[model samples]
Target: MISFGKILFFPILFLLSLIYRILFFLDRSFKKKRTLPSSVTISVGNFSVGGTGKTPFTLHLSKLLHSNFPSIPILILSRGYGSSGTGTRRVSENSSASEVGDEPLLLKRNLPFAEVYVGSNRYNSYLQFRSESRIPNDQKVFTLLDDGFQHHALNRDLDLVLLDCTKLSKAEFVLPLGLLRESYSSISRANFLIASKFSEEWEDLLSKWVRKYKPSQTLKFKFSPEKLIPLSPGASEVSLKDLSGRSIFGFAGLGNPDSFYSSLKDQNPSQLKTKSYPDHYSYTKEDLTHISEKSSDQDYIICTEKDGVKITSLIEMDQNFSKWFYLRLETVLENESELVNSVRSFL
Candidate 1:
């Protein structure tokens, strides 16, 4: 797979990584002050960059909090990756992906009871939500940071970091050099290290970290394929059987797009074709037109639920996308009880 392009490109990537680390060091040292939220804060973040199942895991955590402590209110904080505005904005179920980030809006829709807010200033947003939304004196409120491992501006009661075993199995290095923002040595800083996308092939690597870090808790979770619901409104439930022997056009804008395509292949589709956009990609009309042309012969078009929010919004304006559908991905934390117990003890 080595190419002359990569040979020249890798050196540039290495240089960029060096500069990034230096800036990160300076930023952390200069800030000096970290704010503590009024409510208990549990951050579900990743050491590297995007696509560590932060959104899905946040949703999972919200469910746990709601179920375990029915009286408490939960607040989710997100950076609103693709938002047009820079200031803090409250996300509602009807909010468009353009106003808030796609993930925040998706979170709002799924967790209708929870409050989800997006802004660059997480600490400010956290304070604003707390000041505005008052609760009973006895109820415990929690603030969950979405993809906020490096947000040193605020402190957390528990920091759940994710290590993508799929990508790590190949190589481990810093930033542009590899996927890590820092070295594996810093893995100990996290209260819990969650092994995301866990597989038998990478169990040894996870074991190595467990031995070295000896973190308070090391849990693993798998993102399994859930039911594929039709994107078209009132389209009815569709199952895996629908894709068998049928041509499928799968597309996603995810950190690990290949993983999604692999899942698509497992359905035993007669013909499988996929298109990948960069992480947090904003789909445009031209992009849809291209996909339409590429998948003209495809029987069905499917994407991840994250991508579905944007696609679904756009599809609402057009009636020609009857073949559109989105596959839901759920997380099953292996040591769920233990992890919950650990948090419960802290609370």
Candidate 2:
């Protein structure tokens, strides 16, 4: 029998659960079925807000897919998270973070060879890309949807859900109290799980949880620091050792700022200080002035690539602020060949 104390304690949680279920039901019931013509589509997504390394995974997966199946054109689709642009738009080389959002802009900058498009409506976005580009019908195309786990309107061949090891222990309530977009049980919808950034304890917790509600496969991986790349154009790349013993001030406008700071910490800087802004935050002149002021004493002001995308455009890169760099993160997926093969089989 249910205890009265338990019932009273969980009243708010129960109400939130009820609301989530209703929204879930409504989503499933009214979501319009979307279509794409003869293109292999894979979605990389997370259940929580935005901290998971979806962009890196998507980039790595695209490279893998191209390596496995040469001659297939890859198109990246995103909702343009914080961009002000409306409707379906292709991100260009010169597009600002405000025009195409940070992720899409970063994607374009990183993978200049691939096409990146953004639309609130995934189906419409694909259509726009298809119509504007007009690639030959004989060409093989594979589309990767970024942050697409919950964007269920569009059809996808496989869904690669990234489970943040950091969030494994957080309270599982939806929204207002917890970070989950849906209940942990919604993980069953995931075709494959990439358990990322876990400690030994977190790994153990994840393993027990997965055994209780196992999906197809749960692969473990870490987000390793690749290199320190200059945010300024035409600048050469530098190794972690290049900046050793330097005073570094780190800042990020990210869903998980601590994770970025920790990555920066791994490099063993002589002095490390950090500032965090809200996720997808657009920087103002005042904010930049404050960051510059705060970082004045440091030898370098470092940030994640996403923050760099937005920051570099707004702030002039004169001598006063030439000490900035963005840390480029790479997806160091475990069992790379096996994971590729697993995804290939699905393809």
Candidate 3:
């Protein structure tokens, strides 16, 4: 039975929701339309609040675009949620996660050739790109908007939405109670739907959902991070052979820590100790101290590239903490030909 207080609260929530919808609709109607530059702006985002593999997908798209057109100028625009710097700032070798956000830092590190910028307003970042004349005008510039599905003012050329299988069934309820940031109907605006972490069975269900929603097109993509890339310069290139019979303390502060833990387990096939932190968590000295105290008995303490960046400043204070290493994960399109063909068709 509903409590008396909850009964009164439900009506207030309904009223607020009605007001929010009205404002949302009005905002959509009054929003300024900014035409995308001659450059193709492909936005990779999701309907859910978080943990749909958007960062990895954006990185994968950048790599694919770069490999196909080596000389083409590609720029990645991210909101840089936790970044300290304000306005449009280009990420560089010297940039830290605290300045450019952890995901943007990871992208810059992985795709050093591509230009990466972080700004709250994607349109402003695009304008900044256009204003820069140092880049050749003849070269085709492609902008990959990271987590920009909700930012309708920028007007993206392609809208690719990623959906995690784990949340597919539980996304019925709206935000706070559930993971969806917007109503399911909002997916109708997407040009393509990417059901990440897809299996054969999940693909079938995704197809059904796509048909029901009547999205422009539906494509199945799987998110498999490449075998751990060593973070340190000379980590001896560890492989399955080296991981055998070794005790490791795996830890990460990513959206999907469980996936990272599972990946490590697959490589070792042994019980591994793990510690998980909130997404994009900044590590304090106390946090490192805790990790060191808990992992004293382990052979090595491993973390994700996202977490690894935060530890850099920490290690400088104490040399004994240098032994902690990170595993870098790269996303690859399972079907290269299909992905390439799709982009080519769009171009």
Candidate 4:
């Protein structure tokens, strides 16, 4: 999706990208950033449009902060892109995906101890949160700003930017022209560079690219299979052993569906087939019906946590709920100790 072609439209897109760049620089020069009092905000985002393990890394980083700074309350701010809501709303485990958006609700469910809020303007959301909550003098908030690389209005203490190794080379142009939201040169603004969905295949290329930019630090991480979580209520937790030698019909509405299928394949399934949708896609009844027909021969139907949240209601109504499962992925950060120590010195 990021590759360029030798076409006339390419030049036109490049020209428009230049205009976008000018506006970006102007915004950076003129914009005033506001910081929340008693908060150390760490932004986990990327310059590209597609998946680069941003959400998983954000979750991992929040847990890291919680482990190191137990007394601090974790505040996660997100600009809920797909939700129909207008104002900032606190996401809870019981909250519907339609209310707070899928990712925020998922984060809230995963980190019940953390406070997750979604709104278009994160600065205003933080202000609203502060007005409502009673903070102790000794406790400072550890905030995780999700997908906030382009959110220049909010001041952040640390910027953690993720780049997908698989799409790094292809993303040569910015949005409208290519998959990247901004040019890779923008990485210089990042405090920490994260290479997500990493493998040895891109090591030399990644190293050369990193050497070119000389980021403060670079972290490598990959997704690993956690467990098979059944969609049916009161159903016992399924095992990878159960998944082994079984046919899988996997589907995902993610920035990069290939990454999901690749990880799922590692479970050693007998046969693997997949369907991909656009990022943050909302599944409908018609979509589920189509999936059901395609996956009729499959022993199990698998989807990512993101897709699972949106598909639960539809599957719950079906009689074959037992075959529905979501693959929970755990972010495996390499050289984690070094990163932890670096952050500890700051927070």
Candidate that scores best on TM-score: 4
Per-candidate local distance difference test: 0.81, 0.79, 0.73, 0.82
Q: Give the alpha carbon lDDT tens digit for every residue of 286-333 in model 3.
A: 888898898888766788877877777666443475447776564545
In model 1, the Cα lDDT at residue 172 comes to 64
lDDT of 4: 0.82
lDDT (tens digit, per residue) of candidate 2 on 212-280: 778777777677788887866666777888767888999988887777888778778899998888888
**132-250: candidate 4 lDDT, tens digit per residue:** 77776445787789998888888888888998888756636666676677777888898889999888989998998899878888989887788888877767777777878999999
lDDT per residue for candidate 1 within 1-347, as digits (tens), equals 33466467988977898899999878767766565444778888887777777777788889888888877788999999877866988898888898898899889989987999899988888777777776544456788888877777887888898887777656566776667788777767788888888878888877887887677788887887877878788787678777889999999999877778888898899999988898878898778778888999999899988898887766645457778888887678787887678678757
Error of 2 at 339 (Å): 4.1
Model 1, position 254, has a per-residue lDDT of 90
**Residue pair clashes in candidate 2:** none
TM-score result, candidate 3: 0.86
Worst 10 residues of 4 by lDDT: 1-10
- On lDDT, the stronger of 2 and 4 is 4
Clashes of each: 0, 0, 0, 0
Candidate 1 local distance difference test against the native: 0.81
Residue 334 local lDDT, model 3 = 62
Candidate 3 Cα outliers beyond 4 Å, as residue runs: 1-21, 136-139, 230-233, 321-323, 334-342, 345-347
